[model samples]
Target: MRLVHPLSVVRDAQDWTYQDVVDIVAKATKRSADRRKAWKWENWGVEPDAESQAALAAALGVPLGEVHRLGWPGWLPDGGPVRTSFPWTMAGTLDALDDTLEHAMPDRRGFMKLGGQTLTLLAGQWLSQTPDALAAAFAGGPVDEQLVEDLESGLPRLRRLEAALGGHRARLLLDTELATVTDLLKQASYTEKVGRRLLRLNAELARLAGFASFDAELHAAAQRYWTTGLRVAHAADDRALGANILKSLSLQCYDHGLATAALALATAAVEGAGDVTPRTRAMLLLRQARAQAACGNRVGCDRSLSEAETQIARSTTTDDDPAWTEYFDPAEFHAQTATCYADLHRPRLAEVHFTTALDLMSPAKVRDLATYTIQSARTHTALGNADHAVHLLERAAQLAASAPSHRNTTRVLTARAELPMTKKDPKVQRLDELLATLSA
Candidate 1:
């Protein structure tokens, strides 16, 4: 006899609905109306005996173990002792199939179309559990795994919702949601509760999809998310969370080269995170320093960096810190500081920081490698070491090739431009040739 896994049997039976399964069993048995009713046990009735159990299994073409698994009345032949052989229930089997379907269909657009009703129902389920999920996911533990899984599960539904609404309609819906959330914030009693927190998360999701618009109207959406998230954090009386949200906004500004705005946001975060933990304060200050350096404010940047170091030193324990701020460490700070110095044309200072930063970096942060290598080349060029600069730039170019980023490509191109002016350099010529190949 062929043995099938209980799970596989359940999956194969999924195409037959509950009612369909009952109908199939009824027809196969060819019982009279009263006998069919007795065998199916639609209402509460006595359990089936061993002979009846065998008959039902033969009709259903499923293992008797499968029927006995549910532990329902009439599940066993003659309502005998509970069957230990059955490993899973029909419901459990169906649920496994449901989970399998959800996992197999990760792409948002496809699933929404294929399972619209199921997607909607699951979305509601996720929303109902949002508060608990958020707390656990952000709390640092096995919760992150579940949180990611939930997000993955909900993504298809969200995509479907977006597709149904289209661009303009979706923006309108987001705007309306944001307005409702803002109004909720006005009521002091609800400010610190689950309602406000959910709204904050909703705003963040809207911002993530905003860039998909044609005109790229994501800036307003991003600001809405940050602002709402800050208010929610404040309501929760979580200073670190508020600071982290502000830090995200500052990084966005920095990405756009809005140095002044980035600096302002980072400084505000440092100040507003009042009496916040020393580690959090250091992180905010580090961001401030990075922004200042980007703006060519050498003195201001150095001052912020020093302050950050001092704060880090003052911390006795960093174990209970926020998840977002955990990425800041001595090496990361030094690397960022090196980039600042390089931008300011202080090659010696840049070299010191870059070396320290490089030493601290892990192999996983491969993208950072290109940035650090490029900085090293620029520093060498500034120091009048053309040979070393050429060698470093070549390495930087090779790294850049492996990972294509427009911003890093621009940096490499600029570095190549500087090579021609170096005095009587074969290395410079060779570097130029390599860069030429890249352009082609």
Candidate 2:
């Protein structure tokens, strides 16, 4: 058995893929590597050329001499692997949360991590884990109920601020708040009722922190928050919240073209969520539909979308659902529907849904509004409405400029790339110029 290549092991430990290594090598050492050549180094244990080894060394922040001393995999830095298979117990949940808080710093590499098989394994664990297998008991100072309630009450306000400003502005604040909640859980004694509520709050804060990290384009940070949040939610016996975190991870994976993992996560989300409100089901199903669409499962996608629509229609303002889920209004529903159609290459249908969503969306959701606007412009471009597309791009550009979200700004950048550079129209040229300045 050619034991798992050390090169491959090192890449996994660093939470990167072949492309990430290639790009980083070029950036770090100004040396370009053919993808096929790099793949052989990992898959076939081929010794890289001196320059390639030097580039890899620089990318991994290791001494170049190590390449000669240890050779190949031996010279590669061992950063350790990212852990995902935590036991489904309260103690395990606490440990996961604590580990992430202490060590999972933001991915300074600013790239998505490789999770090909790990994502599937994670969802499988979530699906099979027992719900609230053990009760939590804490012996500490008395926890003030009012303080817990105050923190809970402030959640909506934090969300509002996140929607109005960008995630970068809100992420640190969310992390700080989560740390406060975690400290209370560890040090302050509370009744069973209070403890449960605090645990749920911890879960929600972690989930919100993940969402903020994603919006800020910190992929590894988002994963840390999301996985920890899922464990916390499971500990609280909040199946719906746990499912919601899975859906968020699914969306992130889908955004990065990890279709298999995205689909697995989505399936786990719906299957694991028991006895949720109609809108909550709708949100999860919509995510599942997108993954299905990405996988070319038109039948499954259509079925899931239809079911999502039915569930959403049944949802009412009076439903006893989590307050955070109220955002699954007509706007969010249609936007997700549009995403599925966009992935399926049905631009006309996507444009129609995007139009409806924009019509219903509140201006307060600046980051979302800006992102969807850019996406809607892409559909317009696909439909060959160049003139109208330019108009929409201009509108999206203004929206993007107003928001500080790295995600929203990235959408604008992507849209700029999709445009026809040769188009001499002043509006098109102007849109490009305005977008080019954003990253600067």
Candidate 3:
């Protein structure tokens, strides 16, 4: 007879408790009392005796005395060789989580040490399953707060991960996953649940790639990420997510001087996200107005802006908006509008919007500060106020140095370049010097 570990049998039978195991054994062997006597009986031509117990003990690699002490004849063993199995069994799952926590905690001790590579791995695993498991791993506490806080604090790490992945690798990974997800979604049984998961994954992948492309100075590539992200969001039937992706794409287009494309994309986003939550509608409208302004469509820009403001005012509560969509506020909308006006050479309007945006900005967003300061500086330069432009530029440069973002650096450099042509005054020399320093 082949021997099996008694504990393994208990686990397999879902009878881990000693009382449950005792009941199971009594039922299996048909012995209400005297388990030893039952084990000593030879029945159905199977080995069942003291000699069998000794043999089972040897097979289990445990001492015979230990088996006898348990008050069992031990026809089967206490510990025996079992067939190799998948490593992700329930017990293994707990073990894996423990091991992951052990490895992750020490490395993540400091906020500065957090990176995208680690967060991606951890988040991918944690977010893949039910929140219950993750909560249990965290000692049965709430997971939502931790997840949000971690993601917010780990944005820089995610940015680095994007940089490390680059365009080609990111594209390949996203395309492959997209194909697999598409196939999965075709199955009737998995159409709803799995489709939603695939859509979320696709959106996240594209967002990451988009950020990477932006960091690498590949605006076109970034646009592609947002475009694909929008498609995936639509497939998932997440209008809010689709609108957000479109907003991002529009901003990319505007930044790259494709103002018309930006407007078109933003318009499409608003239309496709029809009857969406008020906040989302307002955000899309804001993006549309910004794009129109950038393209010099003053009347259209003003109309869109008015519509956005109206929608924002009507949205008395943000409860209808998606969780991710909460990042956009009136300030961010106004700041982007200011950037559009600055691009259109409407300095007064730009200044008003910029001032509003500056007041609304949080101290934690250093990168955003650098970007907005650069935009403000450009607006001042366009108005031929070289002194204010220089001062803003100085502050922007200082912030940019700390943030060290390629996109922000490029924006500042481009703004500085424009100053030399716009200002014939001696300040042009200072602008030239700043441009040289940026180049160096």
Per-residue CA lDDT of model 2 for 322-415, tens digit only, reads 8779788899999999989998999999999999999999997776788788889889888887678778878877777777777777777777
Alpha carbon lDDT at 93, candidate 2: 82
lDDT of 3 by residue, 27-121 (tens): 54454544433333322223444554454355446686786775443334322221112132223333332332223211111111112233223
**TM-score: which candidate is best?**
2
Which tens-of-lDDT digit does each residue in 1-440 have in candidate 1?
Answer: 11012211232345433355345445656543244444245323445445544665676465777666755332322201111121132222223323322221121110001112322232222222212212212211222233334533453454445434333334444444434433333332321234335433433433323322211223333343444344444434555566666666676667656777677677666766767767788888888888898789889988988888888888766356654444566777788778777767788999998888878876544446676788778788788876777888888777766544434566778776776465356777777777776555
Pairs that collide in candidate 2 are none
Q: What is the number of backbone collisions in each predicted candidate, taken in the order shown?
A: 10, 0, 1
Off by over 4 Å in 3: 1-191, 420-440
The C-alpha lDDT values of all candidates are: 0.52, 0.80, 0.56
TM per prediction: 0.49, 0.84, 0.55
How many residue pairs in model 1 have overlapping backbones? 10
Q: How many backbone clashes does candidate 3 have?
A: 1
- Give RMSD (Å) of candidate 1 vs. truth: 23.7
| lDDT of candidate model 2 versus the reference | 0.80
Q: Which candidate comes out best when scored by lDDT?
A: 2
